[model samples]
Target: MRDWWRDLTDLVLPAECGGCGRPRTVLCARCRAALGGTGPCRVRPAPEPAGLPPVHAAARYADEVRATLLAHKERGALALSGPLGEALSGAVRAGLATVRAPGAGGGSVLLVPVPSARRAVRARGHDPVRRIAYAAAGELRRAGVPAHVLPALRQRRDVADQSELDARQRLANLAGALTVAPGCGRLLSAGRVVLVDDLMTTGASLAEAARAVRARSWADSPVRGAGSSISGPASVYGGETRERRGEQRNGPAQQWAGRRSGRPPVTAGADSADGVVDGMCAAVVAASPDAFEISRN
Candidate 1:
């Protein structure tokens, strides 16, 4: 009832810009530009986590972007989902472009949103990430990309609030905290999976989410042993290994690694033959400003 009433009120009320409280508009044009003006780019936390997927973000979480995100997340500015989703869609496209390769299946895209804790959801009366994901799927579809929202991840255990936690502590708190919901693995296999989040800070949550997805996916598959064939985006070609391809030119693996470390951007390709590779990319609307720094390493 709270969410329903909020929706009704939003329709009847004189709106203010979520970003800067401008009168008579839900979002001013200037603030809207701030959300995704510069376009999406690769971002990485300073100390990237092991197994963290390559991530793309639409904007730095600062100034108007920060205020706008908080308004939608904490203050029930539900209408902001549209613009937020638009930003996320840009990031999604950017991430997809980097990982897709030749022979990659152009099937439907699955956006698996990082789940909030049950308590948080109850307090907020809406799932912010999931809400934004649906809007993002709409944006993708309008752009001629088939997309779907797949709420496949869930919190399997309680975690401490991340606001006060340092990077190491945040990681430790989220370790083993997430799991794939039962009966979702088969659906996950149906399309390319891209993890979506509203914001990524230390990247602890995304790392844990990736770990859970990989664990469940590998466990459910019948093919696991050494003889089992495994393929990755840009890692396989006609009768050639990634090493051979790398020797010939900078291949997909190099692009994937380089993107995660904020190295110079390189073109890569997306693949769908393998769930492992299909799930190794993520997108977000915003991230810390420092995350956009180019790493010299």
Candidate 2:
């Protein structure tokens, strides 16, 4: 298989720091620090676009971080996933904190990665976002919190590449492009869903994905039995629900729907039997400098 061959090749290939040209290791310590520094920060592109979710980026896309992301995403530096995931885990935690709030239930965090285009997956030979999501989940579990990766979101229709478009154009291209997978509605009804991506550019993609998820959660479908109080369309997978904020011992319970002053209000749906219908936050492994700044040029 192609993956089998690629794995075998990686094991035998000479390793070098993906960020710098340093030899003998896939990533050197200094570069690793660069990738992990300052933890995560809230990132919003300048001239913020409509429907954009509050994104937490692990590091500013600069210097070694930029090189490392390109190496893994474009040059097939598969070994970089570990470090990249480590970096992204911080962002995931930050996003969760913002949404869940202090004293909120940490019960179980479900990471839902934004689906990559089939064409892009075929070209890359692997699904980078999913891989990183898995890594991030692993990191979370190791830290004692329950976590899982959910590839429940998918592209419903084909869209043009976003790289060439401006904010408005990008939003138009991604509009109606994503949907929850066949059974994801039930899964989401049961547990918390956090959209995960490798990078946040204009944030149009995350916003669209979140919108699709919200739509499916509200569809008047049959409710299936999952452990969670909220049930939705029947699914083979059982339901799960987030613990009440007051029930948690880790501090104050956080509400995902609260809007920070100066930030646009978070768009959410009417409350259902399950609970509040607030949308999930987005977590990115890294972001380009342009990610925080919209080009006015």
Candidate 3:
């Protein structure tokens, strides 16, 4: 009801540019360009966390981009999701270009949003990442990249507020805090999976998300579940898993039929019998400028 009312009010109320505060416009032409950035580029945080997937970001989180994200995420500017989604789509496409194998086509792309805490959703009256993900999916479809928003990951424990935490601390706070909800692991095999989020700072959130997906894939594997491999816990980044490298392989999870924050909130996969997670790349609307620098360096 709160989300419905907010959506209704957004249509009727006079609006201002989310990035620039220009009256009567949800977003201005200039700000939209800023939001999209110079085209998506790979970004990596300094001291990138272990298990973190390769990530692409549309824009640097600064100036108009920062203001626009805060306006939509914190201030309920629901209309801004459209522009944000478009920006995210570009990043997703960039990620696909880098990770996808040649001639690997046909399956729809899955935009698995990083789940928000229930408390945050109640406080904000909506799930911002999921909403933007839906919009991003629509944009991808229109552009001929069959896509769907899949909400499969969830937080298993409370986490400290990330505003004050640096990279290492943020990582420790989120480690082992997320898991793939039951039954969704099967769907992860249905297509290419790209983690989506609004922003990336330390990369801890994405790393943790990658970890959870890898863990779930192992559990879903009939061979692994049967303890057939018996080597060790599946490594998400190890060469053993095709999903980690963006290739899909048939595995226990696939036999049944599937495929598959923020802080600056750490809000922020597929399978084979070996429990290889599919497409371990991530896309975000923005990332800390320093992360982009780290990528270049």
- Give the range where candidate 1 is weakest over 10 consecutive residues by summed lDDT: 232-241
Q: Encode model 3's per-residue lDDT on 207-227: one tens digit a residue.
A: 777767666655676764232
Mark the regions of model 3 whose C-alpha exceeds 4 Å error after superposition: 101-106, 224-278
Tens digit per residue, CA lDDT, model 1, 102-196: 23555678899999989999999999999999999999999998989999998988888999997667766877688889998667666666889
Which parts of model 2 have CA positions greater than 4 angstroms off?
Answer: 101-106, 220-279, 290-297
Query: Could you tell me the lDDT of residue 296 within candidate 3?
Result: 39
Kindly give the stretch of ten consecutive residues in candidate 3 with the minimal lDDT sum: 259-268
Using Cα atoms with residue i matched to residue i, what is each candidate's TM-score against the true structure? 0.81, 0.77, 0.81
**C-alpha lDDT of residue 225 in model 2:** 25
Error of 3 at 252 (Å): 32
CA lDDT of each prediction against the hidden true structure: 0.74, 0.67, 0.74
User: How far is 233's C-alpha from truth in model 2 (Å)?
Assistant: 16
Q: For model 2, how does the per-residue alpha-carbon lDDT over 1-297 read when each residue is reduced to its tens digit?
A: 766777677679888899996998989999999888777877766444334445778887788888988888777788888899888888888766545321245346788899989999899888888888888889988987578998988887899988788765776687668888897776775555678998876666776776666556646234322233221222111111112221222211112222322222324322345533334667898776765443221
